[model samples]
Target: MSAADAELRQAFAQLQAQMVETQQRVSALEPQMAGLQRAQLHADATLQQLALAGAGGGGGGGGAENRAYQPVGRAFLLQPLPELKAAAADRRSNADAKLEALKTMKDYLERTLKNSENNLREMVQQRKEQASS
Candidate 1:
């Protein structure tokens, strides 16, 4: 093969490897994104429950005495209701941000894969024409 053909083949190989890696990354992100979405939904629900409880003054008439149990890793800790609500909101926001970032990465990988496929096809066509000539 000519040097140019060799170079094209090398580039095509690299693109194929990149495409495979990107697909793996996308596959990995799929489960993580689902988990994050579930966490966000849980947090939102917790926050809404807190809001409703607070609005109804249903904290056993002690108002600020309401407590909630929050999960920290594998353990649960007691925290004030307001603090728990704030933490849940923060968690939801963080999950939202991470989900967005993953989606963006997925989009970028897809576009790159498409472009690389087109480039490889063009290179192969050129190589075939050169061989025929």
Candidate 2:
């Protein structure tokens, strides 16, 4: 094969490898993303419930001393402990980092894949021109 063909083939192989790696990274992140979404949803629901309870009681004696709002088993408390809040913040930061990494990988793979396609098209055009001449 000509030098152009060789270069094009090498690029395709590298692109394929990058695609595979990116796919695996995305697959690994899927579960973590789902879990984070679920946790955020639960926290939002708990906050909404607290808001509704407050609205119903009009900030009276029943508002602050809600026995029903006692958090249990992953229930996000409106006033979480300081340590617990710190830990949760750390978890959120980690999740955000992973999500950003996944997005970067996806973008890189997309650009590289497009480059491979363009390179192959150019190689084919070159071959056609050579044949015609």
Q: For residues 17-93, could you state the per-residue lDDT of candidate 2 as single tens digits?
A: 76677567657767866776666555556556656655575444655454343455888455523333344556556
Compared with the true structure, what per-residue lDDT tens digits does model 1 show for residues 1-133? 5887778878889978887887788788899989999999999999998877666765367647777678889999988888988888899999999999988988987888788778778878987898899
For residue 133, what is the lDDT in candidate 1? 98
Predictions in order: lDDT: 0.84, 0.61
Q: For model 1, what is the error of residue 113's alpha carbon versus the real structure, in angstroms, after optimal superposition? A: 1.2
Residue 57's C-alpha lDDT in candidate 1?
68
Counting only residues 3 or more apart in sequence or on different chains, how many pairs clash (N, Cα, C under 3 Å) in candidate 2? 0
Which structure among the candidates has the greatest lDDT?
1
Worst 10 residues of 2 by lDDT: 79-88
